[model samples]
Target: MLDVLVVGGGYVGLSAAVAIMQAAPHLAIEVIEAAPEEAWKKDPRASAIIAAATKMLDVFGLWDRIEPDAQPITRMIVTDSKTSDPVRPVFLTFDGAVEDGRPFAHMIPNVSMVAALRDACAERGITIHHGLRATGFRDTGPSAELTLSDGRVMASRLVVACDGVRSKLRDLAGIKTVTWQYGQSGIVTTVEHERPHEGVAEEHFLPAGPFAILPLKGNRSSLVWTERTEDADRLVASDDLLFEAELERRFGHKLGTIRATPDRRAFPLGLTLARAFIAPRLALAGDAAHGIHPISGQGLNLGFKDVAALAETVVEADRLGLDIGSVNVLERYQIWRRFDTFRMGVTTDVLNRLFSNDVTPIRVLRDFGLGVVDRIPGLKNYFIREAAGSSGQNRPRLLGGQSI
Candidate 1:
């Protein structure tokens, strides 16, 4: 019997396994992934890893491998304007460190981050079964039995679901969710430019949604360009010339002849917050627990936070000779994360609704608010720290690079 069975071998699942192994290596850990072997190699998108998340990776011995491919966000500028505006004046600018001279976040290629985590898991002797889908699971008092799509059953003391926003395991566990779709979609793609970005990130709040230009390792930038769902579908399916023309309209000439990289994709935006983070001997992590808009680029960081908290909670429980999967034990992890997740979900929902529109009065108010925030250095620094994942009263052990 496996001590821990994690469904979904994405970054969050792998991180959860790694954290458990780091804290309690004696316990057996295995991850079941629905995708075929090496499928993660094809993810072309990049993610913003906040300072706290980076430290967690460092503790896991994966940051060194990831840092080489990461582009630090040394500065961030936020602007509000119409998509057709010829000029966009920056309303808020944050430039500096979160702590110890480290930038608040770093843009890391998804493939690089996954590869690092995979290598670390390999080093730790963690088993990952690819092409295995968790069809269902049930609590059997002391342990849970998981059913695979191939008619096989595996027993484990606990099951952690990181299967993503549409988690089948979560449904099988009978956990409910609060979900709503935004009428927008985020068009993600990489762009090669003649000019360097100088490690600066920009968020242009256009009428449709926020268009973010995040610096990459080279003379390139990753774009999280948002648009109405219908418009996004058309733009993504358009010819290269047409797409580039539309892209350049908002991208401007500042990047000096920008062209979209071949890796282009669009993801529908939505908010899906799990009503309960835990069920019996089961726990939820990553997208299985919550999904928020990309307006703040905190989706992955939120998952990392889950990884840290759940791992710490389990390890501490085990250290005290308690059943790691007991409702009482699992509730600790849920309590630590539920409110935080709810808070962020609401924050993103409100921000998306507030910014993804053309309401004149609301725009005026928001822009004025941004301007005021820009002038206040203390408040700006506070927000920077918050984005860095350093604002909470209690910092998790893994988040601070400390072992449980």
Candidate 2:
């Protein structure tokens, strides 16, 4: 019998397994993933790894490997404008470092992160079964008996659902969620530019949604271009030249000549909040627990936070000879994470609704608010620290670069 079984071998699930083994090496762990091996490496997108998340990677002994490929965000600028505006004035500009030397965030390629996590998990002797899915799971008091799609069963003290926003395991566990679509889609792609970005990130809040330009390691940038669903589909379906033309109108000539790279993909935007973070003999992590708008760029970091909290909870419980999967034990993890998750979900929802529109008065109010925040150094620094994940209490040891 496995001590722990994690469904969905994405970064979150892989990290969860690694965290548990690192803290409690005697425990057996296995991750079941529906996708074949190496399929995740094809993801072309990049993610903004916040400072706290980097600390977790450092704890996992993967940061040293990831840092070389990570592009530190040294500065950030936010602007509000119409898609057709002749000029967009920056309403807020932020220094990307929370401290004197450390950057608040880094833009890391998805493939690099996934590879590092996978390698570390392999070194830790955690097993990952590829092209396998958890069809269902039943609590058997002492353990959860998980049914695979192939009809095989595995018993583990706990089962973690990291199967993403549409988690089938979460459904099978009968956990309900609060979800709604945003009517928008985020078009993710990379673009090569004539000039270097010098480690600056830019967010242009157009009428449709926020268009973000995140610096990459080289003279390239990753674009998270959001638009209304219908328009986003047409733009993505258009020819390369047409796409580049549309991209340039908003991208401007700031980075000199820019051309979009291949593998242009669009992901629909939405919010999904699991009503309960835990069930009997089961726990939820990553998108299985909550999914929020990308306006704050905190989706992946939120998952890392979950990995930290839940790993610590389970490890501590096991050390005390408590059943790690019992409702009593899982409640500690739930109480630690649920409020933070709810707060972030509401924050992103409000921000998206406020920014992704053309309401004149609201735009004026928000732009003014941005300007106020920009001028107040104390307030700006507070926000920078918040984004760095330094202000919260009871943060898991791993999140602060300490082992459990």
Candidate 3:
């Protein structure tokens, strides 16, 4: 029997397996992925990885491989305006560096991150099985048995589900979630601009939703443009000329003329919070545990936080000669992560509702609040540290760049 069996071999799953195996090499850990081996290479999405998550990657010895491809967010600016507005006045601005002089976050391509994690797993002798789907799950007293699409049953002392928001393993394990759609779909794409961004990230809160321009390496930027679901589909299917025209109307000429890459896609936005993070020998991490809006760009960071806490919990339990899969042992991880996850979920939900509209009174109130936060240096610094994931107390060892 394997000591740890992780489903969904994405960044989160691979990181979970690698973290445990690196700390407790005596334990057998493996990953099961539903996608083909090369499928991860085709993903064009990029995520904002906070400083705390970089610390974890540094602990895994993979930061050096990823940092070269990442673009640090040296500054962030927030604005509120209409889609037709000629000018977007900035309401809040945050300098990206924390007290230690490290930038709060970096925009990294998803493929780069997964490539580094997979390489780490390979070096650590962790096997990853691809092109297999998990069909069922059963938890006996001693171990959890996972049923695969290939008519195979694998038993492990513990099972970790790092699958996405729509996790099959989460359903098979009888876990329920609080889920709701925002009727919004975020259109994500890569655009090449005429001028350098200078590592500045901007979030323009329009009536439809927040339009974000996150800087990438070189003269490129990644855009997350949120619109109502129906309009989003229309915009994505429109001709390139019309699409570029509409994009320019909202994107402005600050970065000069922009041309989007052909690999653009739209993802529906929603909030999903698992009622429970653990059940018997199974623990859900990443999107399997919770999925939130991208307003704050902390979705993936939350998953990394889960990986840190879960890994530490299991490793320390094994060192103590305890059942690593026991509810008691897993409960510690749940307690450590549950409140934080729920709080973030609520915060994103509220922000999406509050800003994704054109109410007159609300516009005044929220913009005023943003101005207040911007003028107060102490408050702005506090928020920047919070976004960097460095302000919390009693964080996991890995997040602090320490070994378990």
- Residues 227-297, candidate 3: write the lDDT tens digits: 99999999999999989999998999999989999888889999999999999999999999999999999
Candidate 1 residues 135-216, lDDT tens each? 8789999999999999999999999999999999999999999999998999999999999999999999999999999999
| Model 1: residue 20 alpha-carbon error in angstroms | 0.7
Question: Each model's C-alpha lDDT?
Answer: 0.93, 0.93, 0.95
Rank by lDDT, descending? 3, 2, 1
**For each candidate, what TM-score against the reference?**
0.99, 0.99, 0.99
Task: Rank the models by TM-score, top first.
Answer: 3, 1, 2
Task: Report residue 373 deviation for candidate 1 (angstroms).
Answer: 0.6
In model 2, the Cα lDDT at residue 33 comes to 94
Residue 262 miss distance in model 1 (angstroms): 1.8
Model 3: per-residue Cα lDDT at residue 116:
99
> Can you give the lDDT of residue 359 in candidate 1?
93
lDDT of 2: 0.93
User: Total clashing residue pairs per candidate?
Assistant: 0, 0, 0
* Candidate 3: clashing pairs of residues: none
